[model samples]
Target: MSSLRAYRQIVRRPSRKIYVGPVAVGGDAPISVQTMTNTLTTDVDGTLDQIRRSAAAGADIVRVSCPDEDSTKALKDIVAGSPVPIVADIHFHYRRAIEAAEAGAACLRINPGNIGSEDRVREVIKAAKDYGCSMRIGVNAGSLERDLLEQYGEPCPDAMVESARRHMRILEDNDFTNFKISVKASDVFLAVAAYQALADACDYPLHLGITEAGGLRGGTVKSSVGLGMLLWSGIGDTIRVSLSADPVEEVRVGYEILKSLDLRHRGVRVVSCPSCARQGFDVVKTVATLEERLAHIEEPISLSVIGCIVNGPGEARETDVGLTGGGGGSHMVYLAGNQDHKIGTEAMVDHLVALVEKKAAVLAAERAAARAAADEPK
Candidate 1:
């Protein structure tokens, strides 16, 4: 049997805390969720729309590529309009990094070593400092330094860590330390190993990800397995689930990964069983419909939807709201783990939605009152 203690608690790694805008990452701060925009940076409105939706979906930070002058020029507006902190993605251009900083970016995602001469590197670092921006040293296995590739003969964990250290040295040598690092790879094994090695190598915040992790479904699984291993080990601080799907999906999946480990809680968490022959209701369709209906809820809630009494009541007893298939076209509804009432199959979805919304309102009011009490001149 799996150890319940292991599932309930994780001893996170000790690391220096840093800020991506006002959002704290690493050390004792809550693990942050991040995603990147797929829209063109020049399309400020479109990018801001995506960013707004992502923030609404629970993205604490968002990255947008700055490949040219126009993107950096547009960065001014994007930064002004974004609901969450923006990290300018500067793959290789030192100038772009500087521009992004001046444009009010909260962070700049770049490898300092790749920014050319020490003087040029200092310029970008200076810009970051002047603009009150942090930085991210992103090292990908597919883009390892040629020298390291020749030295290690492959993109192994050691190679990736070495690459990170090289870039880290540039920042540290310049007396810059407000930064996090990521050693990502497309392969799960490679990404996990590199992250593990890097985690122990430095006290810098680790930005976890499986870079280029395929489509929505495939990427979610690959990232879950890869990120899950690291997060379970308490190695990640801020995370972005790289997916070829919509950026909002990335935020959603990132939250799901974090939610699975109980690292962070946001939105409704549905617990459903796969439909079996004994089922009296359409378990699959019901669960999906409820998920969409409850997507707007940001408050944490546990809901179970099982097809029959076999395991339904058992699961229902642990959730905030639950539904179990019953006889004569009526199904059981559980509220706060108690048998509340029954509903017909035709009206089940709407009824559950109403119950969840009401529960959410109650929780929100309770939270507000607590916050108000805490601020009562204590």
Candidate 2:
């Protein structure tokens, strides 16, 4: 009886459109995926190379930390060489925000409260406007303002939302509307509740994230629970899965979240059944190997790996391509839901990967042909 029908009824809030370089972040635009760079921003070439890798991995926007003048100065080169839009992460330094804007960053992310006076915030805003860059006010529980902490006794959801409101009001008062907001907490519940409150308060697009979300496994779960709730409620505009691992992993997790929600499609989606007593062969290892090989493939395709013949065919029937384990060290290979042939278990992984590559080529060609036909006049 579980359904997505009622979830579809949630109305998305209206917000003004803003561009972070070439990617649109709000106002009916597709929810964007972002990741920050772990490379020292001062290493211009290394940073640019990582940015390219992130863009190639399906990241929509990239953020670089500008912790000092050296990194701030290197922003110009990084921005010039970056394949995707770049945002500068500034903390407790208004001048660095100004420097990053002038260096051609698409956006500047700063915590207004931590960056000092109202005048300093305005100075950063003025620089952002001058450079035609947007701003993101990132409010995290670990860094909430002292007064708000004293008033609320903790960095709770209400306190976080209040901090966001205060920063937002300052920017709005300066007539700066080209900005987004993020209120992040390590606690999943706190993060979700803070976003819900902000969604009800204003239409400024939200950059969803759970701050300090642990390593790959823990971070993925925390971010999914918090961001999934907000996205399901039509509350997030952009997302970053803050993992302690490589920044590229963050981009991958972001896309996976969007893919699960049916909001964005990128790379292949694999469906594999857990092996049971009825399983005929080693389905787990086969599926894992295939997944590793296809990690970088961006074309959207579905592949199912089932353990037993009983429910395998029926389940695989719905996928683009599939494999079902059988006896005698052999397996059934399915293409477009039809049993094509039987192959030995040792060769199954390679065969399926080759089949997928062949199918991907055909799909790519068909898409190109369609595009070429569309360009031709009647």
TM-score of each: 0.98, 0.93
What is the Å distance of residue 51 in model 2 from its true position? 1.9
Candidate 2, residues 1-378, lDDT tens digits: the string is 248665555456677678999889889899999999998898899898888988988989999999999998999999999889999999998899999999999999997777889999899999999999999989999988899999999988889899999988888899998999999999998899998898888888889999889999999999998898888778889999999998889999999888887788788888888898877777788778898898877778889899888878997897888888888778888988999899887787888888888878888899899999999999
lDDT of each: 0.95, 0.88
RMSD of 2: 2.4
Residue pairs with backbone atoms closer than 3 Å in model 2 (clashes): none
lDDT of 1 by residue, 71-124 (tens): 999999999999899999997789999999999999999988787899999999
- Winning model by TM-score: 1
Name the candidate that leads on lDDT: 1
Report the C-alpha displacement of residue 126, candidate 2, in angstroms: 2.0
Give candidate 1's whole-model lDDT. 0.95
> Candidate 1, TM-score vs. the true structure?
0.98
